[model samples]
Target: MEVDGNKFLNTGLLLVATILVAKLISAFIVPKSRKRLPPVVNGWPLIGGLPRFLKGPIFMLREEYPKLGSVFTVKLFHKNITFFIGPEVSAHFFKASESDLSQQEVYQFNVPTFGPGVVFDVDYSIRQEQFRFFTEALRVNKLKGYVNQMVVETEDYFSKWGSSGEVDLKYELEHLIILTASRCLLGREVRDKLFDDVSALFHDLDNGMLPISVLFPYLPIPAHKRRDKARQRLAEIFANIIASRKSANKSEDDMLQCFIDSKYKDGRPTTEAEVTGLLIAALFAGQHTSSITSTWTGAYLLCNKQYLSAVQEEQKNLMEKHGERVDHDILAEMDVLYRCIKEALRLHPPLIMLLRSSHSDFNVTTREGKEYDIPKGHIVATSPAFANRLPHIFKDPDRYDPDRFAVGREEDKVAGAFSYISFGGGRHGCLGEPFAYLQIKAIWTHLLRNFELELVSPFPEIDWNAMVVGVKGKVMVRYKRKELCVKQ
Candidate 1:
């Protein structure tokens, strides 16, 4: 009995020791696991704080800024995203080599839709070749013709409003912009009856960027299914368009034609699938960003009458100076209107975060004597939505002031390359930027000349789940025909 009691006591002691050791190890490791974060971090520990972030990415960012400081860490979906926000950090995104940090790692989820052969999926070498071809086709000379087409398309779209009682501007504008982009960038025939289905697919695929996919990329979830469907539909659409272009012997001027004519460094022609993916990438790149920005553009104008009048006056002078024609040269001279657009972008950039992942280990220094070692797989993001609103970058950061971008101001000198990243930066910078600018300018010029506009919705409340910074409810607007009491 004594021996058995002694054995039982030994076993109990061993169990107690094991539990104590585990408690000690956890206490030591948990705090150490949270050393100074890499350049940035999103939220607190296991709780993730995703609800806080989902409230409004931009708003959450604003709330976290003072609490977390310029650089901090947050966990979302068991993943760490470090945000190196502010103008200085934002500048690094433009200047940093694509080799040191890259977009592909962070945006890999898009591959299911964009395809493996797409420029967005390929290595820097292939992207270089593709971007060169894209730039040539979308350069100033090529854009002039497309800009004219965009203006005509805008007129037709607005005509649907018909001195309107009320209309959902966001929905109508997205359709208009995407259709015009498909026609001008892809090809006219590609913009036919098929786009209604294509647009629906794109919308569904865009909704797939949830925590589920971030956690399990291969799962047969709704997001994955929608992504797959969009990919197949897009591929089919592009295949038909390419076949039509070949059969008709169409001129190779549009972006689709550029893909058809491009040759890789080995002098091999791009495959049909390659051409299709490239076209889809271009279409996706152009449509949503412009639509979101334009919607905000209208919203901002409605809220601020003074700014709206200034834009209208500038448009009037531009039309009179250039005879109501939109060319690249005329676009250059619409300086005040451009400033207004810039101000709107500053206030509500289409994206809250410009995500990039470290391709290799990197080091960045904060204002303090602290340095962070960013690991190869670490996700890095910058919020132009935040950077553009920085008090140091803009004098009155929250105020919607176009004069901030007027001649000779520090805001005016906000480096077109990096500091102002409404279009993003680096080698991966948006190829459709120039064309997008011209399209927005043309739309504004045409509309401001013809209609008196007012907002019917209490200004848009942010929908953070949106691929772009989008609004939850529809933005309704009332448009009255301008009395020709004075011709613009």
Candidate 2:
């Protein structure tokens, strides 16, 4: 028995050795290069450029994009990622027709949180269909109700803060945005029942995007296990909701309800896994980005009192015009407010880079006629952070100028179609732009109108280590009750 066991162990070790050797060989050998791909900072030998890469969201692509010039490559783990910066090349990621660039393969890393068959995992066609359904369900008519919910929730949140001392806008917005998105996407019942689980899932999932384990997720890492558990908890919650909703023969007109009623291209109802996946996708996208933006917007308002005052004046004007109730039309008509939000997204976009995977070998020619034939399996990324800040696109790119988006402004038409890509670009762009706009605008409008924020610090420092950009110190501000405040 001992001899047989020893022989079996030896064979298993031999097989493992063979697989590792093959993988190492495959990683090292690049096919005959037609063009020289950009040189990268040296990193760990087997991991390539992973050692030098930023440990935060988009793995520090935000900082690297500027210094590395227009096109650069970095070997992460065993995989090589080529980042395309500026509006022109970045547009190729969003606008190329019949291209092999697909978001599914690259973004599938998110599946541990978003689940299989989710928007991030699916192709453009399915993503569009799911988005269309969400749009129909959460239409402009439906937005007023969501705004009302936001008002109520904001009121509750403020009551708890109660003319606060120091509050973590990060935690505050996380709770508020999740609560608000839950109300808008799942309605009150589901949001109430599953709120804690949803929050926990998002918290865990956000941690999962760390660059460390993303390169080797199955390696028995603590973050990996937590990520899996988070997904399991979220999936369990969604699964129970799906089963109950189906069993009760009831459906509400929220995003989840839309998924439940949806039929695939084959004209059959979506599977439970698909439904849960879609729900998770909607919640993840809807919640986090909006939360980050709202938090930043609030912080910027506190820091820039003039902009804050303008926002308050705009909100007051809208309230007066619409009799103190926030309507979709009222929110939409706040042109200056929209511009401020656009400027905020310009200054601090929720997502730093647009990620895609090359499905086949492709040639790219810069306008200057510099050409590179990129082979398949190379991860491709585009930066809206860079595109939105391109000097040619915006005259004073770094300035937070809302006038850039103001009505009939030259800045609106002064530059590239691909320049402003906060919601991303082309077919794979964010499906919830309108929904997100409404949610954020409503929250800010309510708060700005109802409160006065005094910033203690001159500026808040942004922590860019994770998927979402957050502040190191909670945005420290004193919120004076609106009822007691005089016009400044």
Which candidate comes out best when scored by TM-score?
1
lDDT of 1 by residue, 84-203 (tens): 766544556566788877876777766776676876689888888877878877878788778767766777777666654677877777788887887687776656666677768777
Off by over 4 Å in 1: 1-60, 76-78, 207-211, 368-370, 412-417, 483-488
Each prediction's RMSD over C-alphas, in Å, is 4.0, 6.2
- Looking at candidate 1, the ten consecutive residues that score lowest on lDDT are 33-42
Q: What is the overall TM-score of model 1 with all chains considered together?
A: 0.86
Pairs that collide, model 1: 40-82, 41-72, 41-73, 41-74, 42-73, 42-74, 43-74
Model 2 Cα shift for residue 225 (angstroms): 2.8
**Cα lDDT for residue 203, model 2?**
74
